[model samples]
Target: MPVGLSMRLISLLIVFLLLLPSTEMKRPGKGKGLKGARQNLAPGRVRVAGRHSRSRSSRLVRLPNCSESTESGEVFVDCQDQRLTSIPASQMWLKEPKHLLLARNRIRVLNDMAFRGYESLTSLDLQQNQISLVEEGAFQGLTSLTTLLLQHNRLVTLSEEALIPMPSLRYLRLYDNPWNCFCPLDSLIRTIQVPSNRKLGNHARCAEPITLKGIKLKQVDPELLCKESDPTGDPMEDQRDSTNTLKPSPIRSKPDAIAACHTYFFPQMRMDCRKQGLTEVPTGIPEDIVHIDLSHNSISHLKARDFQGARSLRTLNISNNNMEHIDTGSLAGLLHLRELDLSDNSLLFIQYGVLEDLYFLSQLNLGGNPWMCNYSIHYMVYWLRLHPAVRHSGLLCHSPLEHNGESVEEYVNSYNRECPKDRQHSQIDQDTDPELWQTVMEVQREVEEELEPSHLKAPQKYQIIRLS
Candidate 1:
């Protein structure tokens, strides 16, 4: 009887032990479900690293609290397309994100210390926003930043000392800003004249004086301010008459006469007329000219006839000359041309839609010319970005913004300042009409030539007169 009772007790004990193993297995599954529910409640936590430990194949480590403070060099913040208005200040607490993109948002102002405390940040993108103002010291603490993009904004003026703290900053973009062409923007204009630097604009003319339109800042003569129409006589008055008579005026020169050169040269033309001091665009470039180089000359203006007959022309270079403007009708026939260069000259303004006809053009050289960072310059910036195939070489900004005061390349990049519209409109002289205003700017530029800081000496006899 005792042995039977013992066996029955032992059987009961074995049954309970077996049930315990099954219950333990069931608890793990139940815990998993609860954990999954918690994860659903905190989606941002799932985005953190290590939550996807099940996927051993994925190497991307989730960052701990994207907005939380981190120990340097541990994470990345991809806030692109998030429709953000301002970058959350908590980002400064992140442990050195390698890349931070804040593109496509409504960010308007970038305050000082906007990106403070993150020492290991390398790349930052603030492109495609409505950013209009950038306070001084905005980019102060980003020492490791290499590439900074701020394209497509409404910047009008940049102080000289704005970008002094960004020593590691390499690529800076302030394109597509409505730069106000005025005295306030002169420093920014001078900043873009450095090497590896580029800008997108036609010219930086004086917006205050009617006579300074289309005149590049490099060509501006502060002395012209003293040359207000002399009571005795104007020195440039006779120079103007001489210059006009030398050219078969744009209106007087027949389109056919210009086309005559096109017929003689036929499909392939190579005319050597360099250093001739020629004062006008050569007539009759062949309709199918493959290459036409008229460099190192004294040509002062560009007319519609310049490229009228060149239907199949591929390359045209007009460098090292004095040109004040790029008319809309000029170079209208370059349908198949791939390369065009206009460098080292005096260009005051690049009118809107002037290069609208260049469809297949791939390479465009416009360096060694003054590029003003003003509102009137936005047209060129927008156009260049629209056509990716077209390459701009030797482009430099002559503005002196305090942020990028020493660097020239930073001028073309995205920034929060630009030149003004009054610099292009609202003529600086007494004449209010557009035509007369244009004339005043032109004449004033010449009057101020004596004030230019070049090796060429100005005539000492000329009395002081203000061009404005």
Candidate 2:
């Protein structure tokens, strides 16, 4: 070999030796690296790694401040006072929680799936929250829920379907909330009033309609509370007419049937006072009488205290009589009254709220009466329209030549179409007689004064005033 070639090879060898340490350092170690690679390549090890990652992610997404525990195979969650505006999504993972305490929170509207996951929940305490507007089916999954404390919440109305899912619910605390006592609440009231059901808390009272202030929810008359008048005109204007010269017919001689007033005890206690020529409601009627028939009589007026003695009266018949006026409170005490017959009478006007106290009145016969077609009759029309259960057949209009013989429903529709703007004021044009118009205006002013808060004096004595 030549001397230069030997020197170049020696330099190459030195360079190779210099890179040897770095190459070995860059390569993976024999034991640790190979073992790790083998383990990662295995299917079981890969699944374990993926599961660990998922477990770590799930643990990180825990509900803040919500604590849960198991006792006797039942889970109990305590998320109370968490300042939660809604139910935490993490709660959906709870398995058959038996008790859930979410009281003293800031929860507002309870959506339909608010408590969806808690199907086995037996007790739920939602008191002292800002909850309002519980959507239908909010408690859909709470089939096992028995105790529900909804007191001290902002709930205004709850529909019948809202509680249909919780068949096991026995104890319910509903109090300290503003409740609107109206027709929609009738079924709820009936449900809560059941003897076996939980008692409605004392704070459950009317929160609207100044007239019904402080009235207890249990004591509220569902029928009377549901009666609503027209929002536009006075309901009493319909009966005002030019017949101010007509007077109520005087009572004639009593019929011999008065001596044979039959009393029944079967099915229900009832008194038959029909065709006895009764000038007025007969006295000495038993307080336990459930029904009374005084049809075909000469009774001209129904005084305020006429039915005061028959508080238990369920049905009253005064048809085919000379009835001209019915004073307010005349049927006040008939709380359970279901049917009333005032058909074929000479009624010109029906005082507003006169039948308001007949809370359970299901059937009313105003047929064959001389109903005046004006703004005053708006209340009756509105009431009849609102309550389809009210039997109002044959309610014909007797005045206004254009609407005469027309049903009250047809007359109302015509009135709304023709005199939509100023029907109340049009009464003056309907009656050209200034005297009659003046009388109506004076009567209207008197009624307004009577309705004033300051003028709420004792009811005046019943008077036999002429309706001419």
Candidate 3:
């Protein structure tokens, strides 16, 4: 066709030939043997890369002084009471230990990755230490950890981030620490109170902010804790953590019924709630509880059915309180009660039927109370006479113009002498129980005073009995 056109086509063909080699080189898996082997080697390289982490973990510093032993084909490191100031190098264990006991040590602060390389730890005991601060991710690499004992430490607050590493955690002892009961403690308290975490945080109590002092961690109302944190407050500063990465998860609200008390099964079932600053009788006493000590409190009144759930209760100590009134049926269903201590109180007189449920009660302590020596005090005397086998003390009169400082028994005799036999028989026949409806003793006293000046007898329907 044309000599110039042929030469242009040949030059284009040469450029195309040069581009062909570049294109071929970019094709994936182009070589049948060498490239295919490289593809096969890729997976091995990835597996080797994955193993590098384990190798690095193994290269950690060693603790040559750590005591080691074998149990059930698993390694155990017992460094408890070693007076350790900090956690030793975790790579001391060739194989991750099953149990690591660092209890009763002097370890104070647990930083992030504190227990790294202890991936197989099932139980870790750090109890009775001075550890007050736990940074987030402090328990990293403890994936199989189950039982963690942090009790008797100085931990005031712990982030949920520290707990996230131990998914298998079950039993956790966090008692005896001075836990600051405030908004900062919400997440940790909630984690300890989950229904599945029943054995966790048993007997842990607050040690600060007077109002919540001595209150159990489980019973301290979370809503009360969230009482509008000051906007000006730096929560991170309040948490006392420099690296505060905790994003507060949704806290759940639960209805708590367990009393803020310490329960014991050894020797015998007992509930001790002394000096707890209680305003009233605590609810939810366990039915199987045999003894309960509630002295040294601020309980001003005992409501009816307060101890109804404690059917098996044999002994109760409620002295050293502000109790002034014992409502009817307060002691109901206490058929097995054998001992009761009601001393050191503000009680003037116990109402009728208040102690009728203690069929087996053999010991009664009513000392240290301001016992009134009036007609309203007759029920207490009558009960004591009927329960002749009961050993009791502190029945002296504390009031009334003539009966002041006299024995309660003497006041009862004077009352019986003044009460007319005919009128007493008639009243007893008319009323099934003298205090059947439990009229207020103060009302009866007021009626007696109102009737005396006019010398008018009480109406037949009224239950006022005047001493002639």
Candidate 4:
């Protein structure tokens, strides 16, 4: 009605009409999120719309700009050996990327929608990183993704929802992760059954529940994994072992019995020289043994001679031993070794060539040892870089100066001081020694002294009656 108000209204209407065209535009082609993008359909390809980022300083490594017209090829996105803390949100541009490589970085978090636009991504390699917390929805948009490589990272818990998507995902590699022993991890272990159930039969079990206590997770009742009040309410009840039966045992350690009969049951018999007071390696490991656990022993030094008989050993765990240093010669015997866990020992040093013979070795664990972590130790990091095939897991801070209060990732990337200045040789600290075999022997001796000689006598043989 008024002249000035009519002019202002006309100007506003013009601006609104101009904005309508931009909003009505159709969704652009894959990989190109910009306003104007030409559609070109092709396998393993998509094009980025915005300016291609060329900055080397961005922590997030991005795949090459794929176009809708491109063909199948390995989409290289190697930001592996960098100091990244998380997968950047900007990586959503690769809508149809085939391969995404982010190995050997310092990534600690994997947030929700981390791969928002990667709907057609097939293979993802996140081999070696410091990923500790992978929040739910970390892989929200990956639908066609098949192969996922998360072999070596500091993942304590894996939320079930984190992997509920991607039904096409197979060949999941989570071999060398330091998984926390808790109820939250039940879903992950159960998921493994879907892949390896027919092969493992009904005997496969989780090896550890508490970190060092070595309680078999399988032996613990399924009810234990659940909160006493809300077990069935949880969906993981289907994964619980249904066979609640136990094998019958004939012997019982009773005072009235003349002799005590002990029976040991293992998935497979192996050289378990733990606290046995044996100076030499045991001789009776089964030929088909796949996992060998020799932890918590007084093994002062290990040589190739010790493993001469083990040919099928794949997973060798020699943690909490008295090893000061290891040579290439010592590990040359384990040609088939895939996972070598030598944590919590007195290993002050490791020669450059120590792991040279292990070509098939996929995982190496050397955490909790007293490493110098100074300039001289730079070669260790460099060596890790050289062997891309061998998964580095998370780097452990063996010294307080390098990682007193920092995380395992912080020590590996930036805080590693690399073998401190040359100093005089210091005697090994007694507190750090892993020689607990003598203590075990002493305890056995005391038990013997407390028993009467009559108790040591043999028990009368019982008649065997086989039930039909």
RMSD to the true structure for each prediction, in A, is: 27.5, 26.6, 24.9, 22.4
Task: List ranges where model 3 is wrong by over 4 Å.
Answer: 1-153, 156-197, 202-265, 420-468
What would the per-residue lDDT of candidate 1 be over residues 1-468, giving only the tens digit for each residue? 699999999999999998997788688555465445555554343222243235533222222333432234346566666667777543333244666767667889988888765556776778678888888788787778766666556776665566667667665665445655445665656654444444312133333333343344334433333333556555333223333433333364432222212111211344444565566776655454577766787777787656777677777788898777777778786778788889888763477877878899999888777766655665676577678778887655655454223223344444322433356445365647877776766665553352344567555674546577
- True-vs-predicted CA distance for residue 413, candidate 3, Å: 2.4
Could you estimate the TM-score for every candidate?
Answer: 0.33, 0.37, 0.45, 0.35
The residue-level lDDT of candidate 1 at 95 comes to 44
Tens digit of per-residue lDDT, candidate 3, span 147-193: 88787789998877789988998877787889898888888888877
Q: lDDT for each of the candidates? A: 0.59, 0.69, 0.75, 0.56
Q: Which residue pairs overlap in candidate 3's backbone?
A: none
Model 1, runs deviating above 4 Å? 1-40, 44-76, 89-95, 195-468
Better of 1 and 3 by TM-score: 3
Clashes of each: 74, 9, 0, 13
Candidate 2 lDDT, 331-441, residue by residue in tens: 888888899999999987678878777767789888888888888777777666556676756678889887889887787777656643356567568647887876776
**Top lDDT prediction, candidate number:** 3
Instruction: Give residue 46's error in model 1 in angstroms.
Output: 8.0
Ranking by TM-score: 3, 2, 4, 1
lDDT of 2 at 78: 81
- Model 1 residue 71 CA deviation in Å: 20
TM-score, predicted candidate 4 vs. hidden true structure? 0.35
